[model samples]
Target: MRELRIRAGYETLGELHRASGVTVATLSRIESGVQIPSPKTLNRLAPFLKVSVEDLLAAAGYLPEKEEDPNEAAARTIEAAISDDPELLEFWQELVKRDDLQLLFKQVKPLTPKSIKKIIKVIKAIEDAEATED
Candidate 1:
């Protein structure tokens, strides 16, 4: 965390604190390995540091760093793709909540790689369309 922050040009805890809205004490503790950051803190800091929440969580030992199942990886990839797009993500959340989609997902709980790829493609298409519209 400290190395990444320093690489990102945050020379001091105060600079990180101001940019991340995390307290200097908390940043100090985290950098010193005396304390791990909470999810909220990671979320706030990840963007400023140009890192992903999963990467931060893994580095903090909150999430496993090992390779996950393909389905889980696919889900994470999709989430990462949408993380910067609030409108598209909001639409995705609503679409996921639909009964038809929910039932379809239940029927395919352990998603196949091909299906996951297709889902990602569909989402990308939607996001692209939205961007073009904007």
Candidate 2:
């Protein structure tokens, strides 16, 4: 985790703290092996580190590492990418209920992280715009 953060250009704990809002002290403890982050913290940090929460959880030993079905993994990855907040999850779930949206996913069986991030940003921008107009 520490290596990932550093490679992501968060060269110092303070830098990671500023980006993630997870406090330098807590990050310090986690990197030093003195503490393990809870799932929520891992969720908060994963996107900033350009990693998936499942990977982070597996690395932290909170989840077992095992082979996953490619289709299922893609779905989970998309869901995780949109789960930065409750509003995003609500929006994603709504989209999931649409048959047309499911068909789109079938067409793009697998999505890259960059594509997923772009989707997330678009959705978030829409959400923010809606909130302000309300």
Candidate 3:
């Protein structure tokens, strides 16, 4: 953990304090794994440390991975990417549902040259649509 923090160029505890608004003592405790931080503190440290809370916890051996199916893994990956924020999760769930992306993502088969060209065309159409907006 110390190595990761250093490699991320945290420089000093003061740097973490300045960025995370967590006190030196608190940051030290977390780094040492002598204490646990609340979600808010964890969130603040995540970006600056260039690490995920889950990864940190895993490093500390406080968390374990659970087996999941491919679709479940993808959904969890999406949720994890958004930090599981309720609003973002709802938005993502709704966005995928509205566009029916979940079903499509599941049904996508091995890509061939023809299919790749079709995908490029679809992406170009979406980009053109967005580019038309002011």
Candidate 4:
């Protein structure tokens, strides 16, 4: 966790606190191995660190380490990416409901954020075109 925080460019707990809104004391305790972060804390920190909450949970021993399903992982990735945008979240919700696009989620797991945004934009365009046709 310390390594990840440093790699994410937070040189000090104060810096992380400013960016993530997690208190420096909590960050210090977690990094010093004196405390394990709760799931809510992990959720609050994961986006700033560019990691998944599940990865943090597994590392903190809350979850057993194992291979994750690609589709499920991709869904989590997409959900995280769109979490701050209501319109994108709605589009994502709609996309996941379509059986024909289920395989697309598996393929998206390894994509960069820019690529994911492009895919979502394409999906939105397709949906708009279909709506126009109807």
Per-residue lDDT of model 4, residues 1-134, tens digit only? 78999899999899999999999999999999999999999999999888988888898889987787877778888888777778988989878889999876655447776677778888898889999999
Ranking of candidates on lDDT, top first: 4, 2, 1, 3
Candidate 3 vs candidate 4, TM-score winner? 4
- lDDT tens readout by residue for model 2, 1-134: 78999888898999989999999899989999999999999999998998899999998998898676665666688887766667767767776666766656666745676678678669678868998999
Worst 10 residues of 3 by lDDT: 112-121
User: After TM-score superposition, what is the CA distance of residue 14 in candidate 2 from its true location, in Å?
Assistant: 0.5
* Clash pairs, model 3 backbone: none
Q: Output the worst ten-in-a-row residue range by lDDT, candidate 2.
A: 101-110
**What order do you get sorting by TM-score, best first?**
4, 2, 1, 3
103 in model 2: Cα distance from truth in Å?
33
How many clashing residue pairs are found in candidate 4?
0
In model 1, the runs with Cα more than 4 Å from the true position are: 66-134
Q: Which 10-residue span in candidate 4 carries the lowest summed lDDT?
A: 104-113
Residue by residue across 25-79, what tens digits does model 3's lDDT show? Answer: 9888877879877766766777878988886655555678544566665555555
Q: How far in Å is the alpha carbon of 97 misplaced in model 3?
A: 36
Q: Give the TM-score of candidate 2.
A: 0.49
Judging by TM-score, tell me the better candidate of 1 and 2. 2
* Superposition error at 70 for model 1 (Å): 18
Give the poorly placed runs of model 3, Cα more than 4 Å off.
60-62, 65-134
